[model samples]
Target: MTDDAPRNSGTELQTDWFDTIRINTPAVERRAASLPSRRSLKKEWQAAWLLNAVRCMDLTTLSGDDTEDRVARLCAKARQPIAPDLLDAMGVSGLTTGAVCVYPTMVAAAKRALRGTDIPVASVATGFPAGLMPLNLRLAEIEYARDQGADEIDIVITRAHVLQADWPALYDELRAMRQACGPARMKAILATGDLKSLENVARASHVAMQAGADWIKTSTGKEGVNATLTVSLVMCRAIRDHHDRTGIAVGFKPAGGLKTAKDAIAWQVLMREELGRDWLRPARFRIGASSLLGDLERQISHHVTGRYAAAHRLTMA
Candidate 1:
C-alpha cells in the first residue's frame, strides 16, 4: 500500500466497507419536512407532554447498599399511587407501574417483585453504560440478566467498532446479544454522544435494527455522552425508513442526562412530530430517566395542593 493509502488496525482490516446495507431514507431536507413545524414542536412541548411521558423511569444507579430492598421499594412506589400533583398534570399518570431498571446483580430482586405486575424490570447488559468490554463477558452478562427474568435488557453497542465504522461487527454483536436475551426484549444503546455525528448515528441505528435490536437507544446515561436533538432526529429517520421498508418498527429510548419535565417533553415532542402519535406507545418509545419522576411529583404537588413544596421534601430517599 502507498503512503497515501488508508491505514487500518487489526480489527478494522477485517471489515468490508463496500457491503450493502439496504436502508433507503429521504434526503435530509425531506426528512426535515416529515418533522413537526418548529411552531408546532414548541407548542406541543409544553408542560403537558412531559407529564404524559412519565410512565417509564430508569433507576439505573449501581453504587448502592440496599440494592434489593431499594429497587423493590421504587417499583412498589410506582404501582401504589403517584402523587396527585403528577396525576393532575398528566390525568392518567397515577396508578401506572413504571419500570425499575437495575444492574444484573439486582435483577433477581427487581424481577421477583415485579414479576406479576405490569411493571417490567430492565437490566443493563453488554457491559452497560460503556461498551468497552470483551464480547464473551458482555454476552455472559446478557444471559445472566435473561436468566434473572429481566423483562427488558439494555446493552451498549461496541463503541470501538462503531466509531471505526464497523457496521457488520456492530450488527453481529447486537444479534448475539439478542440471542442472549432469550424472551426478554433487547435495547441497543447507541451512546450517541460518543458517536459524534448524525451520519454515524443514522448508520448505527440502521445496523442495530437490521441486527434484531428491538429498540435503539440514545445514551447510557452513565457516560457524560447523553442524548441530543441531532441524534434523536437521525434515529427517528432511521426508524421511519426501517418501518417503511420492512414493516418492522424499532423503538427509541433516549437515556441519560435528562432532568427537567421540559427535558422529557422535548424528546416526546421530537418523537410525536417525527414518528407520530402511534409511536408514542410505551413499547415504541421510552425516556431512560430516574430524577424526572421526583420532579414530576413536585410539579404535581404544586398543581394540586396549591402550595410550593420544598425541594428537600421532594428529594426523599
Candidate 2:
C-alpha cells in the first residue's frame, strides 16, 4: 500500500490481461511456514479436488436493485437435489454442494429455504464491495449477517488504503472485520483489480492472512477487472508463504469473471498444483461466481447427453 504516490499516476488502475485461453498465475513466493507435511497435504488435496461452488452475495444491487427474480431462480435451483442428477449426468461422483450465497439482508431467507440441505447461507458483510464505510456500521452489518444465519461473511478491504502502501491499514481493517464476524467464517476480498500490481496483491494477501482471514478473495465482481490467474497466483504465493512461517493453513477464492466450467476447472487445477495437496480442501479453496452454476449445469447435461443443454438461467456468455 502507498500513501506517497503522486495523484493520478494510473497507479489506481490496472492494465492489460491474457487474451489467450491458457492459464497463467503471477510469480509468487512459495513455502507457507504454517502449511503441513507431504502426507497431510495429500489428504487435504484429495479431499478438495473438483469441489466447485458459487458465491452470490449482492445479486441484488446496492442502489436498490432488487434480486427477487435472481433469488427465486437460485432458490428453485437449490430446492432440487443436485448430486444424483449431476452425478449421473456428468459421469462424476457428484457435484459440489453449491451454496446459495447472499447478502446480509437475504441471509434469513436463504437459510430458511436451504435448511436441512447441503447448501449453506453466505453473506457479504462489513461494508462489502467498497469497504469505505464506517467501522461500527461495518461491524453491525457483520452481526446482522450472523444473526440472520449466514455461515460465511465475505468482506472487502479498503482499496484506497491498500493502494497507499498502508499495510497496517489493510491488516487492521481485516482484523476488525474478522473479529466482528464472530463464529461465522470470514473471507477477506482483496479486490485485486483495484490493487493494480502483483506486488500489491502479494502484500495485501500476506497482510490479510497475517491478520487471520480464513480466505483471501480476488475481486468483488462489481469491478471492470475481475479475478485473473495472475492475481490468484499472487495470493496463492501469499498463502503459501504465510503457511510456511505460521503453520496455519488459509484459503483462496478467485471470484468475479469466472463463468465457464473450463474456467472453474482450470483455476482448480492451478490451485492444486501451486499449493500442492493441502490447499485444495474447501478449507483452502473456492470459486466465487454467480453464473458458474448454470454453465456447470449445461456442461454436465452435455456430458450426459452428448449434446449441450438447450438453455439454463445463466448459460456461457
Off by over 4 Å in 2: 1-64, 67-72, 79-86, 89-96, 312-317
Question: For model 2, how many clashes?
Answer: 18
**lDDT by residue for model 1 over 1-317, one digit each (tens)?**
01121211112222232233433334554554444345343322444554466664554546547568887777676564356554655555445534677889898887677666777788888877676788999999999888888888898898777779876778778778888888788788988888866677777777777777788899887667687665677789888977776677777888877777666666776787788886676777777877777776665566556776888777442
Q: Residues 22-107, candidate 2, lDDT per residue (tens digit)?
A: 22332232322212232232322322232343322122223245465555556556554243554554445534334556778877
Clashing pairs for predicted structure model 1, backbone only: 58-289, 85-300, 85-301, 86-300, 221-256
- Name the lDDT value of residue 4 in candidate 2: 25
- How well does candidate 1 match the true structure in TM-score terms? 0.81
lDDT of residue 231 for candidate 1: 65
Q: How close to the true structure is residue 6 of candidate 2, measured as C-alpha lDDT? A: 20
The whole-model lDDT of each prediction reads 0.69, 0.63
Query: When superposed on Cα atoms, how far off is each prediction in RMSD?
Result: 9.0, 10.4
